[model samples]
Target: MKRYLQYGFTTFADHYGSSEILYGQFRKGLLASAMPTTPRPIGATKWCVFRSPPTPYSRKYVEEAVRERMSRTLSDGIDILQFHWQDYDDPRYMDVIQHLLDIKRDGKLRIDELGLVNFDSRRVDEICRTFGSGALVTNQVQFSLVDTRPLYGMASVCAKHQIKLVTYGTLCGGFLADKWLNKPQPDPYFDSLTPSQRKYLDVILGAWGGWELFQTLLSVLRAIGDRHNGLSISNVAVRWVLDHQFVAAVIVGARLGVAEHKDDNAHVFGLRLSQQDRVDVASVLADRTDKI
Candidate 1:
């Protein structure tokens, strides 16, 4: 089995844009949002994430942030800079690209190290045509056994252009483990009240055809885990994502110093889910994505 430190290069998202609200959440301070603009002097791959466009601010506000952040890249000689692009149709999309290119052209950002968040196959070709070859490195999205939307088509688009996938939501907010097996449904208000927490359970129960079927799928995963020498349900689920065609990395969130399942997460590096494993697990899932 691969060691946890072997996958230690996964990107960490510090508090949103270095805000005090986020910084206060941690006892030990994390890397700043502008850290992406600074490369590791010893050749380590550096990553940083921003929560959203600094809003309630004007275009000048946005431009100043970009310029200020990008300037650090020039001073520090960084290569790749990462950010999210939620809406491709947004007019600001063009401006964002132009700023990155300007940074690259001026030797602040490396041309080969641009990445965007939340894009899937439908947008891959458009991204390529707009950014050109080797301009982008990753198309980060949600991909897991419980969420295989990428497998339906996104994999092919990414594979064609050599774009790597960075996936998240692999553990489904701790629901993909033994703790939930045969458990009573969580209260929508008192148990799973957070919007995301509720929505994912809905996706799982709905996809598996109902809460009853989801339990069955969990049982199947448990059996598979036992057969594989006490492999974890979390491992099986994340390994399934890695087994997909174009995934490069999976982001498993860490709550600092609370190293609970970091060991199981490392198992993903070496485990391979068998064909029967895939069929058994995917069988109960609904392809209800057509509504969108």
Candidate 2:
């Protein structure tokens, strides 16, 4: 999906040469004329798309904002649009979504589906109930062993409304990998961790019971991986998220040429946690008191 959307081809001049289905597109003009040499392949998937427009209280501005995005997305042959709103207390999200529904109803836009990102359970339920189940397709959120807050309330709402979860942060910003397994915790003031690393590290130390407990969790994951033909801890971490029935997909961040995990990632499909593996992981998790 990244290759086709970003470069307009399935394979680019990169070290990792593998082919996968293009299921979704996140940005507009990713296939625009800037890279005209690579036209979209014939019969490429009309992506389930995502965009974030500034929140506006007026229904008129909301419609205008979405329409502008729709024009760009349609130009790229996309049919679905997902939204991200930060302040739910604004109460204008419903109006914006309602405008989107009206545009779809009026046949003014080509959006075949609408979805949400970072929306809580209550709002998701209200939207589905207000617009009907068919109105929204999925809700994107952070879900992983380290961040299981969704399981408490969001998962139940999704299961009840049949809204699929598109999860991100499953790898805890790359901290759930072999590189950090037995390493000492970094000094936040001096370490050169990326913004993503620093953010998830806080989750690990603050929400996930600090470095000692995190090390214990990593040990259990490593042991589990050893039984599965020396799979990496990252693979096991991702598979744990996929093991959930409510998860439609796990979003792993990629740095096109800088780094690639395509080879190790394929192993996730083949590695399934045994009943004993689940038990061991659960044992470690049971000690955590943080909801996130």
Candidate 3:
């Protein structure tokens, strides 16, 4: 399970201090060296193992791609190669899965497990069911306090298939923290926002009961953090998600070379949410939020 790895840029120095598990949208050779291999991912980017099945849908394409990435990545093998199907309309994803599994069975590709990225509940059900359970073990998705859609459906689907969710955006692009607490709502049109801040800002304004209510949620989180030996708003937010049984891990965002949160985030490791903490967080959600 990968969690607390918030590095936007990766460096040996930054990587050394970051979470043991490495992840993200790859930048070619950045992750090719100096790492303890766990279940590292490859699907989000096109260069992953299976460099992407090219046109013609041939197994050789997949085989060669897998070998190419494996050669570039860990010499022994990739612990788990995660796959992302960009176009469900294209049935070739099945061919990719088949090729990867077939290569693994042949003991050449050396992928121990196959996970997924951003697949919906229905498709996850279908993939596991069609591929005969255990085909995929984890599905990465945008899940957090602001976006709880997974709880209604993804949670049950994962339970049925015995799959766990690898969650990103758990901190709502760093919005659910003490820094944003009681701050005036920034003008979306005029203000500068990072890609993540912009995305979650929309969620906060349109769906999560707007800026005013979001402030309320942040205040509650701050209070909860104070209760927990003065933990930061971030620690409380991350803990809330970790408290859920279905989530295998929550990925927090970070700026590798520019900034590091290893010390700050370390607090979340053993943090446990009390019943009252849950209730306080829930109260904010109950009173002010769309069904999302």
Candidate 4:
């Protein structure tokens, strides 16, 4: 793993509200530990869009932000810059994106590609139209078996623009795993769920047709998993998302040394769902109308 780190394939996303200095130090320490004899990969780091609000509209501010980002992670080799924004109505995001493009054009930064995070379908189409199809490469969004809203509009725009969808939440905050399957509905007060659990639980209850429907979905996934060499529910869930044509990749959250699914996750690559499996899963999801 350390040797792999030296090859520069390790990618890290900037956390909101965190200082760049701290992030740089952490990245540097990891890279320094890697063996120098290893062959270097094409790029090392992927900087996400900075969310500082004071000057979102200012080109100068945007440039400075990019400069700061490059200064911090350039040593690690940044491959792509992914942007995140809250309000789609704000025209300033376009300005910021244009400025980043201009910076890339100027050869001031070594960024290889640019993309968006959590931008809606409409906004993604607008950005692609304004900037041209190749300007952006992907739109990262919360996509999963339960939240298939992206299938409706985002998929078409992405297909048209040739932008792939990098999906997160495919496991629904670990709720889709076998540990929760057939288990009694958790009491929010008595059960100690992680922050992700609380967040996605709300989505499950409010938008995903509540506990009963979720159980049905889980049962369907379990049956599919059992047929495919007893793959875990999470593996089946992720495999289902990967089966989609629009999905470029799935971002599975890790807790480092605390808990790891390295082996179970590896099963996803080997498992293949049959057409009957797809039909069974789709049959369960077809009844739901809520969009996440």
TM-score of each: 0.73, 0.79, 0.81, 0.86
Which stretch of 10 consecutive residues in model 3 shows the poorest summed lDDT? 7-16
Task: Look at candidate 1 and tell me the lDDT of residue 181.
Answer: 85
Tens digits of lDDT, candidate 4, 1-292: 3333343325444444443454566556656768576543322223444444664467687666666666765353356678887765566788888987987788766567888888998899999999999999988888999889898999899899999988888898899999998888887777999888888988888888889889999999988888988899999999999998989878787665666577788788788899999999889887775766
The Cα local distance difference test for each model comes to 0.61, 0.72, 0.72, 0.77
| Residue-wise C-alpha lDDT for candidate 1, range 161-218, written one tens digit per residue | 7888878787777777788888887876787455655877887656535566667777
What count of clashes does model 1 give? 0
Q: Decide which is better by TM-score, 2 or 3.
A: 3
Residue 271 lDDT in candidate 4 = 85
| Number of backbone collisions per candidate | 0, 0, 1, 0
**Stretches of candidate 4 above 4 Å error?**
1-11, 14-56, 74-77, 289-291
- Which pairs, if any, clash in model 3? 6-254
lDDT of 2 by residue, 194-269 (tens): 8988998888889788888889889999999999999999999999988888887776777756766777777886
Expressed as tens digits, the lDDT of each residue in 190-240 for candidate 3 is 887788899899899897799999999999998888888999999888888
**True-structure lDDT of candidate 1:** 0.61
State the lDDT at 113 in candidate 1.
Answer: 63
